[model samples]
Target: MVTVKMLKPYYIKADDNYVRVILAYQYFAVFINNKVYQFVPIESKEIRINRRTKKVENLGARFAFQKGKDIIYMAMSELISLPDFLVQLHSIADPYYLNKEIKSEPNYESEAIIDELEQLNMKRLIDKALDNRDYEAFQSLVKLL
Candidate 1:
């Protein structure tokens, strides 16, 4: 029986389309029949996950990892059985999603303040143009209002 011992990603990068998870040596490991097998990315160091579907995208037919001098192969089918691994993976990716959500949310208070300031500045410019008897400048500034 295979069980995940540790699955901490070295770093995670996410965009609107996908989340890329990079793993390094000693960072991800598993246990098979109570024997530890450390995973080392051989074919590719990065795992690509679709953001919308939350599914592995770049994983080929089977992904290979190194354990000591021996290379072990794991299929996506095998990985699906381990609920703990999936849960931890999602937890690691959760922060990126939360950050995207936070960024997408509009800061209404700050936006209102900035708009008010711009209007006041434009009004001041219009008044100055009027005092200087610059009809062209006054007209342009008034148009901006």
Candidate 2:
């Protein structure tokens, strides 16, 4: 039985398409048959997950794990079967999604301020047009109002 022992990401980079979890040496570990195996990235150290679906998009071609100099190469498929692994991965990735949501949400206070400013500028322009007796400009500005 394989169980996730530790799955700490060095950093998480998220964008519209993907969330990349970069792992460093000893950052990821698992228990296989009561033995601890620490993952060592071979080809790539990053795991790419779909931002929308939250599903893993890429795991390097192969990975190496070490247990006191006894190194073993394993395919990512082996790890995907463990429910605990997915649970932990999602938990770690959830915070990045939350942060993205917080950032993407509209800032109502700032938006309100900007709208007020634009309205004030428009009113000032209309007043100026009226004072100058520019009927065409006044009519256009009033229409905008």
Candidate 3:
């Protein structure tokens, strides 16, 4: 049986001779050395693997790949990463008024928008963040929660 390892380093040699690294909860596997080498974190929308110089590249979401026996899968790099409290906080944005002249430049009524939105509208913001691999955003939202 093919053991489905959770949250561990997984290396697979594609038929094209490239190694792909499977990351936990990530959509695409990292490719390198004409073979997938290692997979990055789930929120890394795009991770570049350079065989010649060992460089990292970024590609926001828009990912695609094939699994064993020719099963294709797709997912975005951006996805909500906020914790419980932050998620709840971000959901209620319309109720309050965001002032742009008070503190920061793009001052929102409340950064809580991100956290609460992700939690309530789980389908929209949360999914979007993961698809784009925006874990940093998720982290910020989490703190607020």
Candidate 4:
């Protein structure tokens, strides 16, 4: 049996100046200021040998969203994770209100992840946090709920 994974919808936000995309625990890309950084899904390749004919076949995956493109592969021996990268982005946009709008919107990855979890009936966690007067947690949860 083939195992099927349920893909969360790609989180996207757009303004006249920028397009921000987050693929949840995977990667995020922000397109703005005439530059774009993308962290996208990638797959590994393997070589299979047919016993009967001794023929070798290379098998790999093409990303569902990035079809028909020449892919250049690169690896960083040491690198920051997506969450950290997002934090860096927020830091750079500081004093510019990129973290949230005036009313504390759910404008970041952590909030987006919480929103996804809440869709799975995890509201009680938020309620408990609110009950305990965890204002920070409450603020994060209240946006998407």
Predicted structure with the largest lDDT when compared to the true one: 2
Clashes of each: 0, 0, 34, 0
Q: What are the per-residue Cα lDDT tens digits for candidate 1 across 1-145?
A: 8888988899888888889888888888888777788876765567677886777776554556666677888876676568887888887776555333434679899999999999999999988998999999998988888
Q: Which scores higher on lDDT, 2 or 3?
A: 2
Candidate 3 lands at a TM-score of 0.19
lDDT score, residue 40, model 2?
84
Worst 10 residues of 2 by lDDT: 95-104
TM-scores for all predictions: 0.61, 0.63, 0.19, 0.19
Model 4: how far residue 13 lies from native, Å: 51
**113 Cα displacement, candidate 4 (Å):** 15
The superposed Cα distance between candidate 3 and the true structure at residue 132, in angstroms, equals 85
After superposing candidate 3 on the true structure, give the runs of residues whose Cα lies further than 4 Å from its correct spot.
Answer: 1-7, 14-19, 25-47, 62-145
In angstroms, how far off is 117's CA in candidate 3? 81
The count of backbone overlaps in candidate 4 is 0
Global CA lDDT computed for model 4: 0.40
In what order do the candidates fall by lDDT, top score first? 2, 1, 4, 3
TM-score of predicted structure 1: 0.61
Give model 4 RMSD, 1 decimal: 23.5
Deviation from native of the Cα of residue 96 in model 4, angstroms: 56
TM-score leader: 2
Which should have the higher lDDT, number 3 or number 4?
4
Candidate 3, residue 50: lDDT: 31
Off by over 4 Å in 2: 98-145
Residue 79 lDDT, candidate 2, scale 0-100: 65
Candidates' C-alpha lDDT: 0.78, 0.81, 0.37, 0.40
- lDDT per residue (tens digit) for residues 1-145 in model 4: 1111222325544443443333442343333233343434664221122323322222232222221363433222111223453344344333333333347666699988877876765578687887899998878877766
